[model samples]
Target: MDKNNNAVELRNVEMHFNMNKEKLYSLKEYFIKFMKRELRFERFIALQDISFDIKKGDVFGILGLNGSGKSTTLKLISGILSPTKGQIKTYGTIAPLIELGAGFDMDLTARENIYLNGSVLGYSKRYMDERFDDIVEFSEMQDFLDTPMKNYSSGMVARVGFAIATMTTPDILIVDEILSVGDFHFQQKCEERINKMIDGGTTVIIVSHSIDQIERLCKNCVWLENGKIKMIGDAKEVCDAYKKS
Candidate 1:
């Protein structure tokens, strides 16, 4: 891929939200409080002055601690939340694995949910049919195909979700801490699958808490602290610095 070919770009992007300072019992109570000038809110800035460019086929990592806006940044890139200011531009189709069960119906069997979830992902019936077996094999849920997902374990659900979400080689794959899915052995399987996607030239943006995982899988990275960029550079250097902090 061309070095100048950008897969994702953000310029001075910022996110803001007004958090309620008090909770009311109902809409009627909220209206009475608002009328009486009792409503209070605090401005929360989730991201500020964020700017970065992810080149085509680049594996980028975002590292941060709890409440550091790491997941918020991924949500912005995945279009789950719009930026409050600045610009964001992305090239090619995006596959976001931010929430594994977003499209799942808990009452539905894994078999039914596979096709339903595929449709939610914008795949046609024929497309899903062709890849159905591959999905089952990847998830290793052959025995539970007919079982309701409501009865499945968290790891089991995550595996199926991950398998379906990554079935195709997307142009841009936005993964948010999904590597923690399943057991240690299954985590390795997930990493191997992601590695395969990287080999296929997918532009992956990963947000992970594991410093070693970030260094191993990413070429470049950014560290965010208090919703601001603390460092941005080679993955190893960034990870090393973040680990020290």
Candidate 2:
């Protein structure tokens, strides 16, 4: 942990998208010489006036309904997507498990894809080398290690992806609803590993629609509604409010 307690900060961040609306004209209408503007555009706001700070060793939970900009907020923090407005500053090395199969090659074997994905996540060949056996064991992928990833089941793919993404320790860990992919046993393993990371002073940000997970795992919480901050406070309180609403 650094001298500053806050590991991540979002200052009035906002993101918006331009949606185009097209007008339909029938052949009869066109023949009658009745025409209008072909295209109209509307600005859709995905995140509005979102501000929060996450401290090192904090298990921060982001809870919201679908399309509430939970994933967008995680992406903005991880540098996967830039915010359209406001500012964000984060310290320390961040490991993000945002999307499964985001970087894996379908044609490559599981073993080969692991190395490729590791490199994409900023791990060197030697680093992967040191952790290779442990990753395979944790993923329970030993049987299909040499098989092409496309041949594996969806669960298998997620296991391998999760194992590779989390093999190396990080100063900050960001998870965007990835625990829903794996089976119950694997989810338990992931939770145990995440708890270990938290114990070791790694800042964790969990974005999930599962209010139970948020309440169980997070010490602090934030709720987002229609791209705006709804609540920020104790995990139990925010979850109770979300459930009631």
Candidate 3:
């Protein structure tokens, strides 16, 4: 692929999380130790030497087991987390459906959350005003729009989240295990919308545990194991190797 055609470029990316050596039971204990400068931390490396390129309009799959850094990679690409070492460059606008309800206030009504979440995603009030009805229609939560989001079930929240995130077609869409939350029917609807976005030339990076889903949706795949790239190639080839391992 041509370098200029790439939507995302990650070069030797490394992420490190600093974990406390000892867990403090309370704020008082934590503050006491902090004043004394006796607190100790252990560094945990989540990803190491990760390098990959996702071309514009490419449907890319990030495959890995639990704690293998797949979600971390998506977070990095979404600009939610920065690499401890190396460089990450993204070419265009991004819509991230990483954590459902993450941008919402549980106390707020679903209708209120539409504007709130839209703002978080960088959409202007005027833009949201124009798309509000469409968002409500797509989510199928018109009746519950006035109700507090905390009262809605997980599936309902997922529906609203997916609807709001996909309200506008972004240049790059990042999905992390969101399809696993909703019911089968809603999942299908979400898939169809995603397919429409993909057909419109939106680059998508999806992190899914389901090999079947990855194979069906993604053309290119990357397998991450123990924070390192194990394989990167055709989706079917990588998924087949992952299943065998």
Candidate 4:
């Protein structure tokens, strides 16, 4: 890697989706049209020629309205979904807390699910074992550790999920709409943990509509509109621009 290269980079990336054309053709014509028309399927553009870079230790905030592709942008960065065109590069490990309980198995007990979630985040079983107590204490699920995750309440599940996602100190952390999940006290604790990670030089990318939280937590921000870059600068300036319009 070049000395000046960023930790995260996107070079003119684009993402698009194709709609089904099954209903548009007859049974016999379907076979005939499948080979010819499938290549020309109707395209819906989700991201358009987007490009950005984040250096090490940069707390990058993504601010956009609903359907502005904020979540999709995070997905791209985390490698959950690939861009149709262009290039995306990340130097270090990424921990994406994109959705609450995303990798969880409802049928599994909380203790078992801890191992599963940690594995999904790229940690070995031994590593999870070492951090097991910290995870359980942070989640406050000591009483329900043996219970199946499906039996837990939404708030309880959020606690476990958030704790599992943050078990390992990742080099890059991507959070999407996670701050509004748990109770006020839990939210405060999570915020403190995230701040500690940032202080330790972790690159953080936050996708949220809460202008106040973004302003308080982020130093730099990017505004995305209609799958394109709208603004990129200081957090307050970009957030103020987003709130007014």
- lDDT (Cα, tens digit) per residue for candidate 2, span 70-121: 9999999999889899999999999999987689998999999989999999
How much is 176 displaced in model 1, in angstroms? 1.3
**Segments in model 3 whose C-alpha atoms lie over 4 Å from true places:** 1-3, 23-38
Model 1's alpha-carbon lDDT is 0.92
Is candidate 1 or 3 superior in lDDT? 3
Please state the error at residue 93 of candidate 4 in Å: 0.8
Per-residue lDDT for 76-126 in model 4, tens only? Answer: 999989999999999888888988788889999999999998888778999
TM-score of 1: 0.95
lDDT of 4 at 127: 90
For model 1, the stretches where C-alpha displacement exceeds 4 angstroms are 1-4
Tens digit of lDDT per residue, candidate 3, span 1-245?
44499999999999999888877889998999999997888899999999999999999999999999998899899998999999999999999998776799999999999999999988899999999999999999989999999999989998999999998999999998899988999999999999999999999999998999999999999999989999999999999999999
> Per-residue alpha-carbon lDDT of model 1 for 35-57, expressed as tens digits?
99989888999999999999889
Q: Local error of candidate 2 at 129, Å?
A: 0.8
For model 2, what is the error of residue 227's alpha carbon versus the real structure, in angstroms, after optimal superposition? 0.6
After superposing candidate 2, which stretches have Cα over 4 Å from the reference?
1-3, 22-39
| Cα-based lDDT at residue 223, candidate 3 | 100
Q: What is the C-alpha local distance difference test score of each model?
A: 0.92, 0.89, 0.94, 0.89
Model 2 clash pairs are none
Error of 1 at 24 (Å): 4.3
